[model samples]
Target: MAVALPGVVEELLSEMAAAVRESARIPDEHLLSLKFIFGASAVQALDLVDRHSVTLISSPSGRRAYQVLGSSGKTYTCLASCHYCSCPAFAFSVLRKSDSLLCKHLLAIYLSQVMGTCQELSVSDKQLTDILLMEKKQEAS
Candidate 1:
């Protein structure tokens, strides 16, 4: 079953889509900065850009989050507003070092947005809850 996207996720997607559509006008310096931070992952992210891999899941109370399923079949969560990702690279690198901005999963999301290839699917509240539980369990192990 399908559900409506939460306000925050919807807004974020709209903003990213607009930015992607207008990316041509973005400054070279900004592009260089992104390149510097994301490194080789920037190039790798492009290959993983697919609309079907990214989903927007929300709780019954309207809390929203993003899930990116990698080509490896692993799932990563991207939280709203903060841009934080639940990936090992994000935790070990981005969080440990302030210089970095994104993991491959997050980079893939950004690249997918810029390429106008991000597909958003809205899932049920129970699905969201189950995803969260699974994430927590994975972390614990």
Candidate 2:
């Protein structure tokens, strides 16, 4: 059964705007979250905007699924059978009362999804490079 992505565009854009606003705030706490989420050495969370932007790409095999790691430092299960993500952020958000479309965890997975899987495409330099070039062009154009 296909999971209905209702109001996906509106939700994604709303989430994007919230992320941008949070990035502009540049709170110390937010920076820590970025480091925790992205595993980047950079202190500013703003640096993640680039990474986040590229996280919407298709996974290998053309699956719509994306990947992400939870704050627990474990790989999230991209269960196609279930519409929900496994990260605490997502789990908590969904199980709780909230209207968020993409929690930070989902966004993290989105970033991971666009970045491609290390297990599969890590060595496919040619394909990875091609994908990166495509992403660059898409962003530039």
Candidate 3:
């Protein structure tokens, strides 16, 4: 199989996501594009959105982040602003091997934001810092 160009693939998915957000309509061809590119991750992203497992957390200090609840019941931190996800798939596939653009968790976050399906919550700045720190700690252990 030919090696996938992460930039081109991610750009396509991002455009499709933006189109879905603006149009509020899902075309069959868009779904097909996602399936062809992201494969199982695309299906999983839709499931995460359907399950309302994506959350946008905002702090009083004007910072925003995301949390994606996995099928295993674990919540992963997703920093969409920086395209970061604290998931094993991201670590292995995206960062380590460069085989994929983002993990299912990050994809779910994008889909949730575009479709207005993600939950939202507000918190203090301190809480936001703690949340980020906790993610780092988990990675250490």
Most accurate candidate by TM-score? 3
Please list the residue runs of candidate 2 whose C-alpha ends up more than 4 Å from where it truly belongs after superposition. Answer: 8-67, 111-141
Query: What's the CA RMSD for each of the models?
Result: 6.9, 12.3, 4.8
Candidate 1: where is the Cα deviation over 4 Å? 1-33, 50-52
Best by lDDT: 3
Write down the TM-score for model 3: 0.85
Residues 2-104 of candidate 3: C-alpha lDDT, one tens digit per residue: 2333675567666776777788766778788878888899999899989999999999888988999999999999888778889999989989998887799
Q: Model 2, 69: alpha-carbon shift in Å?
A: 2.4
Model 1, 76-112: lDDT tens digits are 8877446677888788887887656567777777556
As a TM-score, model 1 comes out at 0.67
Identify the superior model by TM-score, candidate 2 or candidate 3: 3
Candidate 3: residue 115 lDDT (0-100): 72
> Sorted by lDDT, highest first, which candidate order results?
3, 1, 2
Which lDDT values do the candidates have, in the order given?
A: 0.67, 0.43, 0.85
C-alpha TM-scores of all predictions: 0.67, 0.36, 0.85
- Give the per-residue lDDT of model 2 (tens digit) for 41-100: 222213333434223324455544334434444444444334565545555655675544
lDDT for model 1: 0.67
How would you order the candidates by TM-score, starting with the best?
3, 1, 2
